[model samples]
Target chain A: MTPPSGPRKGRPRNADADGAILAATREALAELGWGGLTMGDVAVRAGVAKTTLYRRWPSKNELVVAAVAEQLDELEMADLGSLRADIEAVVAQFASLLSAPETQAALLALFAEATRDPLLRRRVREAIIEPQKRLVLAGRAAAQSRGELPLDTCEETASAAVDIIFDTVAGTVVHRMLVSGEPATPDWISSFATLLLAPLAGIGAGT
Target chain B: MTPPSGPRKGRPRNADADGAILAATREALAELGWGGLTMGDVAVRAGVAKTTLYRRWPSKNELVVAAVAEQLDELEMADLGSLRADIEAVVAQFASLLSAPETQAALLALFAEATRDPLLRRRVREAIIEPQKRLVLAGRAAAQSRGELPLDTCEETASAAVDIIFDTVAGTVVHRMLVSGEPATPDWISSFATLLLAPLAGIGAGT
Candidate 1:
């Protein structure tokens, strides 16, 4: 329902409206693409007034970033028994997410736009990239607890290792599915998991 | 010089004009971005008639793919004496290219557009993705020759390995540089190269 008047900055935001608006943003992106998606259309789709949408998201870029972030939030890493199994599960999850039509349509466009706009780039990194790296962090902790990975003595080296692992896993899947135009099939995921585990095991051994 | 008339389908294309047009396209992408670039602007920048530009590339997608492919073509892998050295060199080279303003501006946008357009996706793969995999293949062969990596006996398995390696190398660099908004500096490259070598050595040993 449209608020009688737009809520003030401190007013409690409507969780329903937030959900609807983000869902509508993703729907519009899938149907209309990045160029065709507009704030007004998203508002109409969400059954909210333009002012309500604008009051929440200042611009289309911010709205789309939030929508994409919400989708990425669905990615959860369960502690599979082994490090290899955990890697495979997460890789499969990420591939499936990227394969979604809305994500397929929105992500690269967002990254492209972020290239020229510093504010938008920071927003994207904060909202999407940074949040997703938590999966890597969590997975690493789980692996270490299992004794599959060794604890790093040097904080700097440990931090850098997380960055490398995150980049490799996320980047490899995105490239295989999007850039290379290949399917991230079950067999492929298994092989990739094996490939990843090798390097990870090496890190654990401090090689 | 402008052709007296647009070259016929069978006539030889002007190499200089082709080069100038592609260069102009990159310049426009860096300055105007994908949304703002136009065929007319590219023609003017190339000092060629619009017809000539159109004759070679029927659409903006085709033209952009060609321009991006030309940039990717510059990437070559030399036998840097060891797999680690070779991987590091190619990774550094790819990162530098992705760092350029025009590539930063154009690549993700092109990939995003290709998500929906099948023909453009094919062109991107044929011109850019497929060709770049050669570097991975060549590097693998070189490593095998040096006894740093084992040769695969199965064609299917070997092909899959190439795909995985290519995706890991390119995707990681692209994600680190573009999506994560982090510099793929020398220190990062060394860590990445070391990580890559471990798994590669495992694969060579038939693990």
Candidate 2:
């Protein structure tokens, strides 16, 4: 039952299994939810042995985090010529992720588990949140370059702005989508963008 | 195990049981977490019959949601004269709630469960989220009176502003406390209030 491949060249086959496993995880989440989802079921759906899945992901938390992180990898930050547009596009993308039935369900489940498990929380933060935060950083830098956001007086101030901006942008989307159970509609996104950019515009225009 | 009391006048006994049950739930959440917690164990902890607990709360989700709602009832929005002080105070209060091990754990667990259970979601919205949103409406109204937030042009615009403000305020506090793993310090709360009110202040001042 040994693989006829070297450790260095295990990417192709492993990639296929990983893809299938993640897809199966999503399917399981959609059907069974986090409480009912089992590694054995996921492996069955993935057409892999339970041992294979266990080898790759030691626990359900690890598997779900990996699956969600893979999904989050699709979030892209394109330079959309303006900060408002860029922010809106990212917001829209995030909204879509939150609106998806399986992803939202799975993401919340991971968050719940993370609250009890420090290691799982760290994994989720690193794999899911940290990458998206880079998009925030990039957008801020772009806004500064476009003369939309003022350059902070000090590094401390800059970091603080980034933290505030990150929480404002990301947190609002989550609240609107999940907490309020409201759709992040185009009109809503536009209104949010306007509200978000108002202060930045004022600062940029020296108001 | 019949009590020597009139069936119609069971308020005192029920209230005592409710308090004991909620306290036991928090203790169980702190010890066993959401995954490990069960109604039977909680009933045992509360020194109540399993049937008594089940008759009151049909499931763990319902029980936990009720227990957490009791905690959330403490989130009062007192008017501290100014929008800034009011917001900072509420933010401080919310930070304290999230910092509590039992409440944070239970809140996230309920949120996760509600993702799949529509009934549970409705209960949570009604009992937890909707009630807190009143504070947003009140704060906005106060800001308008104080010439901090401009008066809305129409009812629709006013509702939209409330939604925006609610999401911004609640979402940012959650992000700071839960996601960023940062304390909502006094200075941090003050800065957050200032950042939040910046654009609104401009509109109010006609800048």
The reply for model 1, stretches above 4 Å from the true place, is A1-17, A38-55, A203-207, B1-17, B38-56, B203-207
Span of ten consecutive residues with least summed lDDT in model 2 chain B: B1-10
Error of 2 at B46 (Å): 2.2
Q: What is the lDDT of residue A85 in candidate 1?
A: 78
Regions more than 4 Å wrong, model 2: A1-15, A203-207, B1-6, B9-14, B150-153, B203-207
DockQ for model 1 equals 0.56
- Provide per-model DockQ scores: 0.56, 0.53
Best by TM-score: 2
Q: Which candidate ranks first by DockQ, i.e. highest?
A: 1
Candidate 1 chain B minimal-lDDT segment of 10 residues: B198-207
Candidate 1: docking tier:
medium
* Whole-model Cα lDDT of every candidate shown, in order: 0.83, 0.80
Q: Which candidate is the best by lDDT?
A: 1
